[model samples]
Each structure stands twice: as C-alpha cells, then as structure tokens.
Target: MDRFVFAGRTCVITGAASGIGAALALHLARREALLFLVDRDAGGLARVAAQAKAAGARDVATEVVDLADGGDRLDLAAAVEARFGGTDLLINNAGVTLSGSFEQVSMDDYDWLMEINLRAVVRTTKAFLPQLLARPGAHLVNLSSLFGLVAPPRQVAYATSKFAVRGFSEALRHELAGRQVGVTVVHPGGVRTNIATSARLSGPDLDGQQAAAAKAFSEKALTMPPEEAARQIVAAVESRKPRLVISKEAKAGDLLARLIPGHYWNVIARVLPKGL
Candidate 1:
C-alpha cells in the first residue's frame, strides 16, 4: 500500500483525552486531518480539542463517552456515523491497568479491566469498521502492550487484555488483506503516563508502600515520552506498518519472547528490577 496520507482525511481516536491519544490528536492535527476525539474525561477532551484546532486541524470534534458503557459506545458510533458518515482512520487506544497477581486480583477488577481494555476495543471496532471499509483506504490501530507479548508477574489482567488485542488485530489484518482496510497492533513499553498512578491494586500486599513503589518504578522505568511514542505511531500508520513496538525495551522484549519462547520469563525476571 502507498503511504497513508493524513491531509484532508477523517480520523477518530479513542482515549483522546490524554497520553498517546492526546499526542496523536495534536500530531495529526498538524497534518491537517479532521479529528474526532472520544474519552470519558470531558475536561481533557475539551483541552485537547482546542489544542488540535490551534495546531491546524481541518475540523475537530469531541465526544465525552465512557467506553465501559455499551449505551455510550453505541451513542458515540451513531454520532460519528451521523456527522462524518465515514472515517479514514480509527485508533482504539483507551485502556486501564490492573496491578496484582492473577490469584490475588479480584474478579470485579478483572471484569472492569476486561470491559474497558478488551471488550471496548471490540465494540468500537465493530461500530467503526463499516465506515472504515466505506472509505477508499482506511487504517485501524489497536494499542496492546509489551506485557501482551511477554507475560510478567502482577499484571495478569492487563496482560490478558493486551494479548487479546494482539490476537484480534492479527486476525483482522489477515481478514482485511484483500480489502483496503489496514490493521496495526501496537506494543508500548512503559511510556511516561498516568496509567500506573491510576491503576487499581489488589492482593494481600496491597498497601501504601506497594502502591508508592509501583508508582515510583513506573515513573522511573517508563522513560519514553508520550509525544515521542505518538510520533512513532503516526509514522507507522503513514507507512502502513502492521505492528509497531514502541521503545527499545519493548523491542527487546519482543525479540526475547520470540527467541526464548517459554524461557523468556527467566530473562525478564533477571533484567527487571524488583517491585516492577
């Protein structure tokens, strides 16, 4: 496929209120793309919409929708269809983190994370896929995680959701191979974001100390800036790359997983510091 141009194209991005999604809105705006942003954070969405307009977006729209709610997700899909008719790009980036071992993590927390991280992705994609296929050329971007490729301790729910995303994106890509729609799955390794701070914790060890340690580790280890990560993602989209693994750590993890297969955990355990 030729390079995916952004100028004069309609693009929709979920989780557009902050992190990589906000950065993507700003970046694509500079390319003069029409922007449709969605998020539960109304205030942040407004701020990002303003910034996108200032950055030279052709048009900017925002919908404050909680993806966790099926009704809200359907409303967002209907609004997009009614307003834009179709979109050239749909990026599913909304996700939350859950901290704790699988055995220790509550079923409620597991369900919550699965709903937002996994089920929401499926719902939004189904809602927007028709519009994507209607366009001459379209792209779908799904944000998986490094943990998706390589499972680690204390992130069972988060990893499970991401792994599902990876599998779904791959299958969708194959299914759309002969069509104009393209699919890209992303594996981001600890970008500097509030995900850790906002992450819900469970387990017998859940305390102020553990929470503080996790936050500190996330802040310290997640060295890649969200803006940089967004830049890479946009570049991948422009090139129609199938899979984009952000950061050197993410790339190394991918390689290790492929090379070691079942033994990757041994290597990762030694490399990753304690409390991470």
Candidate 2:
C-alpha cells in the first residue's frame, strides 16, 4: 500500500483537536508520522492523540494552547524545538469566527480574530522556519478561506484576517521558492465544520434557532465534508501547488475572481447575505 510521504518526519498542527485539524492528524498518523498536536482544548487534543495512536502514529505530543495568547506562540516554539529539533511540515490551522457585521464585533473580538487567524501564522512560521529551512524538503500550509479571495459579504473581520493570510502565504511562497521550502495556501469555500455552531456572538445574539437557520443556509449553499476537503488539500501539497481551491464551487469562485477581478467581488457580494 502506498502511504503519504510524511513518514519518519515530524508534523506539527495547530487546532489539531477538531474539524480539519483532527481529520488531517488522522490522515498523517496513518502514514506513520510523528505528531505534535496543539490546541487550547486539552480534552479534545487528548482524544485526537488517542485516535492517532490507534491509527499507527509512531509517537505523539500534545500542547493545550490558546493561539490568541501572545506568550503561547513562544512557548509552542520552544517546545517544538526542544522536542523534535524541527518540524518537516507546519500547518497553521487554529482559527475562530464571529457571525455578525464588523460594527457588531467589539474591539476585543476584532483583536482576538486578528491574533488567531493572522498573527499566529506569522509567529509560528518565524519560530519554526530556521529548522524547516534545514530540512531537505519542508512544507508550510496556511488555511485561508474563499472569502479571502473574493471579499464575500457579512464577514468583514473574518474576511480581513483570511485576506491577510493569503497575502502572507503568497509572499512567503515566492520568497521561499528560490530555496527548498514549499508553501500552499488553502482557500476553502465551506467545509462542514462546527465553527458555525461555536461562533462568537458579541453584539446581538442570534438565538440558537436563528443561528441554526443561518448555518443551514450556509450548509446548503457552501459546506462540504471535512475529510474530502482534507484529501484535496493533501493532494495539493503533494503536487506542490502554491494555492489550492478545495471545493468545486470554491474553485469556480476563485477562477472567476482571478479572471474578472472587480466583477467577481460584485458577484460574491450579491450571492451572500448582508448580515447573520
């Protein structure tokens, strides 16, 4: 049987407890990789580590951390360097969402969003890059959103963070392309994740029913299974693409955005709702 090529190398994933992170851990574990899982949810990370053990991962380590905690980044970096010397694959997957207008999002909410979605990537990359550069083949993957590409409606803060991720990923890729390091920025349309269920409600609460309805609308309109999304992402990494559009719909949207540019933003704004 053919295995994913990450065997015998260390792979560190943030947000490794749930959704895409958990799923990708499973995928890599089956290939007999060593894992360093990071998440704020200690219980969740334990569950994931157990599953990875069952799936034949050679070894596993866990760190419960909040990405928004400024000090946590340095701690994780130190831990990674101390434990594994360097990571072969680095995935900056920890993120959060707020489901309302920008005005509805408080200063704290906006800052928190920026910290997790954008700054954590920068922090982790800078911390781990020296080791990654030493490896003959190393990969860095950042989880961006389709909203980053086309500027969809009603996700101002979330979109802004992802937009920064895209810019960062692209620039990093070009900068490293001259060397051995490879990067792939994922633009996922909507993978069926619990983010919608756990989204922060700051200004006006969307009661459970309203939130469910909104989630349902998005499920119908955009969401896909997380495993399928992960498969496509891994494939993109294997192929060494700098950018990946994970779903068919997401690909179409990204394609349109690239071809039409200004017209694409208008089209996206028309499709999505004005508010949660």
Candidate 3:
C-alpha cells in the first residue's frame, strides 16, 4: 500500500488532553487532518482543541469523557459518528498506571486500571471499527508500554494490562489484514509524561517510600520528550508499520525478552535505577 495520508482524513484520538496524545493531536493538526480529541480533562481538551485549530487542523472537535465508563465511551463514539460520519484513524492512547506489587494492590485498583487501559481500547476499537472498515487504508494504534514486552517485579497489574493490549492488537491486526484496516501496536519507553506523578499507589506506604520511588524513576528514566515519541508514532502510522517500540531502553528490553524470555527480569532489575 502507499503511504497513509492524513490530509483531510478524520482522526479520533483518546487521551488527547496531555502527554503523547496532545503531541499527536498537534502533529496531525499540522497535517490538516480532521480531529476528534477525547479526554476527561475538559480544560486540557479545550486547550488542545484550540491549539489544533490554530495549527491548521481541517476541523476540530473535543469531548470530555472518562474512558473507563462504558456510557462515556458509547457517547463518544456516537458523537464522532454524528459529526464526522466516520473516522479514518483511531488512536487509543488513554491509559493510567498503578504502582504496587500484586499483594499490595487491591482487585478494585487492578480492575480500574484495566478498564481504562485495556478494556477501553477494545471497546473503542469495536465501536469505531465499522467506520474504519468503510474507509480505505484506515489505521488503528494502541499504546502499550515497555513493561508489556517484559514483565518485572512490582508491576504485575500494569504489565498484565499492557501485555493484554499487545496481544489484542496483534490478534486484531491479523483479523483485519486483507480487509484494508491496519493495526499498529506501540510500546513506548519512558516518554516525559504526567503518568508517573499521577500514578495511583494501591496500598498505604506509611513511610512514603513508594511515592518517593515513583518520583525518582520519573526523573531518572523518562528521558524522551513527548514530541519525539509522537513524531515517531505518526511516522509509523503513515508507513503502516505494525509494531513500534520507542526509546533505546525499550529496544533493549525487547531484545532481552526475546533472548531470555524466562529470566530477563533478573538482569533488568540489577540495571534498573535504584528507588524504583
């Protein structure tokens, strides 16, 4: 297939209020794509929509909806359909992180994370699939994580959700092949984002050590700018790349996982920065 074009194409992106999602909205806006941006932060979404319009988006729409809620997701899909009639690109970028070991995190917390991260991705895809199928060369992008490629200690819940996303995207890619819909699953390393500071701590850490560790990890490991990550993602989408792993750290993790599927964590743990 030829390179996917964004000009005048209707695109829907979740979590467009901040981080990589915000960056993506700007990039696509510059490409003159019609934009539908969704996030729970009404203020942030409005800001992005204004910027997108100024950046040369052919059209811009904003929706403030909590992706974790099925009703919200449904309403978002309906609004997109009503406004744009259909969508050419659907990027499921909304996600949250939880910090704790399996024993420390409660089931409620785990479920909440899954609802926004994995379940929402699946539901959103299902909701927009008809439109994507109708549009030639349509694409789907799912934001997984480096942890999705390799599991580690204390990240049981997060790793589970990301791995599930990776698996779901891969399987759906196969199913959609020869049907014109392209799927791209992204595993980003530590792009500078609020995800770290905003991550929920499952259980009480009386000494406040867990919170401190999260801060340290955010400062030390989140090296890539969100703009750079967004640039790579947009390029991959244009090229119809099926899988993208951003950052040197993510590449190394992917390599290690392939080489030592069972014991990569032993080596990773040693090299991982302290306090995380």
Best candidate (score: TM-score): 3
Local accuracy of candidate 1 as per-residue lDDT tens digits, 1-276: 778999989899999999999999999999999999999999999999999999999999999888777553666767877777778999999999876678878998888899999999998898888788988679999999998899988788998899999999999999999799989999999798888887887766535765786688777788788999999999999999999999898899999999999899899888877656
Q: What is the TM-score of each candidate against the true structure?
A: 0.96, 0.91, 0.97
lDDT of 1 at 8: 89
**Count of steric clashes across candidates, in order:** 0, 1, 0
RMSD of candidates 1 onward, in order = 1.5, 2.9, 1.1
Relative to the true structure, candidate 2 has a C-alpha RMSD (angstroms) of 2.9
Candidate 3 CA-lDDT value: 0.93
Q: What is candidate 3's lDDT per residue for 1-276, written digit by digit as tens?
A: 568999999999999999999999999999999999999999999999999999999999998888777553566777888998889999999999887789999999999999999999998998888889998899999999998999978888889999999999999999988998999999999899989878999999899888887888899999899999999999999999999999999999999999999999899989988766
**Tens digit of lDDT per residue, candidate 2, span 207-248?**
665376557756666468788877777787667778888887
Clash pairs, candidate 3, are: none
Candidate 3 structure, TM-score to reference = 0.97
For model 3, what is the error of residue 164's alpha carbon versus the real structure, in angstroms, after optimal superposition? 0.4
After superposing candidate 2 on the true structure, give the runs of residues whose Cα lies further than 4 Å from its correct spot: 1-4, 206-210, 269-276
Q: Which candidate tops lDDT?
A: 3
Worst 10 residues of 3 by lDDT: 68-77
- Per lDDT, what order, best first? 3, 1, 2
